[model samples]
Target: MLIPSELVLSILSYCDGSTLATCQQVCRHWQTLIDHYDALVWSPCCERDFQKGLRRRFWSLDFPDPQMVDAAMLSSYAKPSTLWQSLYRITKHWSLGQCTTSFLTNYTLRQQKRRPCVVVGTTQEYNFFTSLSVAQSGHIVRSNPMYKGTTEGRQAMIVHASFDQDPTLSSFYLEDDALHGIVCHYSHPASPWIVTGGLDGTVSLWNEPERCVARTWQGHRGRVLCVSMNDQVVISGGSDSMIRVWDLDDAEQRGSIDISSYLSERHDWFQGVGEIALNGHLIVCAPDTSGPVLIFSLLTGSLVYELKTEPQDVAFTRLCLTPFYLLTKGEINPSNRNQVPIYPNTSSSSTPTVSSSPYSNTTNSGSSSLSSLSSLSSSTSTAISTYALAPPPSLSLTPYQLSRYYNLSSNNMTTFTAARSCIDVWDLQTGKLVYRLVPPLPATTTASITDIRISPNAAHVFACVEIRDNGSRRNELCYWDFSNHHTAAPSIMVLPSMTSSSFGNAWACFY
Candidate 1:
């Protein structure tokens, strides 16, 4: 008995890539059928593996993987099957942490003999970068803080680097009402405008082509903490507990979500918006309070959902969002702050030291399919009792005060020892905790996360971590790749040593 070709192809559509590959080896007929209907069989597989097809659509051609150079062009004009295959290869390369690094050299010019160009400030006085964003077009824009002896020298400007021609660089100083530097800024892949928030309680939209502030909106009574904009709307979160939205076309007031209004306790400890991620239809934001992470509808300004946390979970200070999942990082409970053990830096020595205690507690929910993985082994339960516990530093400081202090601090230090360290992954549809990810560092390493960036598809997370051990400090770019879930655990890689000074001022973003 033989199955119809149509029925055989339909049956193969339900099988995964591996199963189809196995089936193709069964007979010549099956192999021919599978090859003929490759698109029908593999499109679903690509969607399943690549975050429902978003990753495949936005995968960069100029990836760090040198092998992608050939595949990049193939993906542009290839068939659906070819394009998906190219995407799968790129994702698999990322999962395995395979890449090559290269530095540019210039020997002809004396000034640029060794290094290609300075990455930081325009002038030698203030030669450090505070914030930077990489666009999909390969344009790099970074904010440089300049403080000369005079009033004119105490200004900040946006430095734009374009590699389209001869690796050119230009500086555009954004004028603010208070003359203060930009506090937070965002560059969207789809838009050329750079939206910035400043200490003057204003949000300025700069036209990159024109090199001037196209418009400025003053809605918040306090300094802005985060700003993100697209072609249509500008969204900003300020210290005033207000998430304001403005029309990009005419600078008209669209709407605002007062975070304090949603809090039932009405406590003075509530801080303003910590971070925000915007898509087309919704805005997911986390306030600088332990209350709850709120999601609001972008069109109607109505509350969509609130992701409440456990009592032990402190305030969520950082978060990024997608249609299906929300990625968040919250502070450890103040009571357990000092109880957490610190791991010493072990990347330098031949033998990496493993502490007898686990860094953070891992608990799995019985109802949810998600399971928390503890990176290190041992019993920290008894270690906490051995040492006298000191009062949490935040006991005297309000959450608002803590948030403000973190913003103003140069190192972005945490008052409490282990604050906002663990990354939590939650399912938006089910509203259940999916994964509680602890950075795979030494259990006892005293480290603080300076910056975090998520891939466009939320399949990978990169964190710039600063580790201090034995009076010395170094920086590591630690990344966890979750592309292949069938593996026992996520692939973890902590890049080698970087100077504390240079890495401290560095910022990263996923285009």
Candidate 2:
């Protein structure tokens, strides 16, 4: 005799999360009831678990409230039961340090006309890419190292592939021989536009759908170091210590800012624009490794603010800017507090180019050593003051409300840490330390982070980490999921060809 579906669901509803999971595997009838009516069965389970102890203390303000989602704003995008269940599972997995990894693909060097240098112990071979971009659709595009050529041709190329698949050899090449090679590039997350900055100081926009150059512009007197763009504007920082703004539509020059003029002294020939982040309105630029980051108005080409970092934490190679906060990766000095000092340009009118650095360039008072971490922790850190940058009208919230909405308390500040293997999140509104995120790695191995990328909502952070274990080195692509997206898939399919090396020798890791 079989039990009635209603009666079975009622009985299952009384069960805990673990018991409910077990019931689904007992028989097809129970599985059907549970899977079809997941909302009814799992919603309560998630709430119960979350209330008891599954809260993530990340910077997000939407904690303990099972109804509010910090990542996706659309209610139609995620079903209630599914979202709750996914949240429960992901939180449990992250907190308990549980995840499965698999090797995807590795790169090999092809035979070249010039003598090739032999690579040793996965260090040089694995660090092949200089810059990479990821889209919302899971497509990853990588700019190749600026070298002479492969067997293909003298011009440099950019490789495109999906996150789960191997990179295809078919790529867009910089055809102009005058532009010695490609240095940096940016790809729109949703659109078909791709912009590349070349050694010859040329920026070319490529239309992926048409697979041809849409437009080109040349202004930089030296090699372009970094490039970033939106749909309307393209910003390029070059080795000439000049940052140029271009209109994406007609390829006309919008404005230019010389980095050297603002600095205290002249920069070395090797020290040029190293990183740039653009959001159409503002351009955050770093000229050299150690930085007093300069912010420029994209439209007027005038200096807006100057952000100074402690000497220990000023080796700025990466820059990510949101509407309110600026994130840079550098050497981390872990102290009781990890606050970023923001200095407003008090002399913007009288001396627009003068740096407003708080600390003297000679004094290293802020320098501190990094502490070791056995596991991820939410321990508190230092504090700083917040600047009132208005939240976008789209959010429809004031700076105070925005801070409270994001659970930033009353500090109105944001804080971040830059340990090699760890990343931190700050509340720009409150000027307080929010979250310190570290990827789950084995306690026995030593790991170093190569790159870190944060989603626009600050809900997800992706880390590309290389770990050394028992004399062998391997890479891992790890992400911290704060949203209830399509995480619980039926099964994972590993590509057969992805297991083998396409170029020379391959190294692979699970996603």
TM-score per candidate, chains pooled: 0.60, 0.53
Whole-model lDDT per candidate: 0.50, 0.48
RMSD of each: 11.1, 17.2
- The CA lDDT at 208 in model 2 is 59
Q: How far is 41's C-alpha from truth in model 1 (Å)?
A: 5.6
Backbone clash numbers for all candidates listed: 5, 20
Model 1 clash pairs? Answer: 331-420, 342-444, 342-445, 343-444, 343-445
Question: Under the 3 Å rule for N, CA and C atoms, how many clashes does model 2 have?
Answer: 20
How would you encode candidate 2's per-residue C-alpha lDDT over 9-110 as one tens digit per residue? 988776655566567668988877776786688776655543343222332112123343332322222444455444444443322222222222333222
Tens-digit lDDT track of model 1 for 146-220: 422233555545444333133544434544435645777887444568888877888888876666788888888
Q: In model 1, how large is the Cα lDDT of residue 39?
A: 62
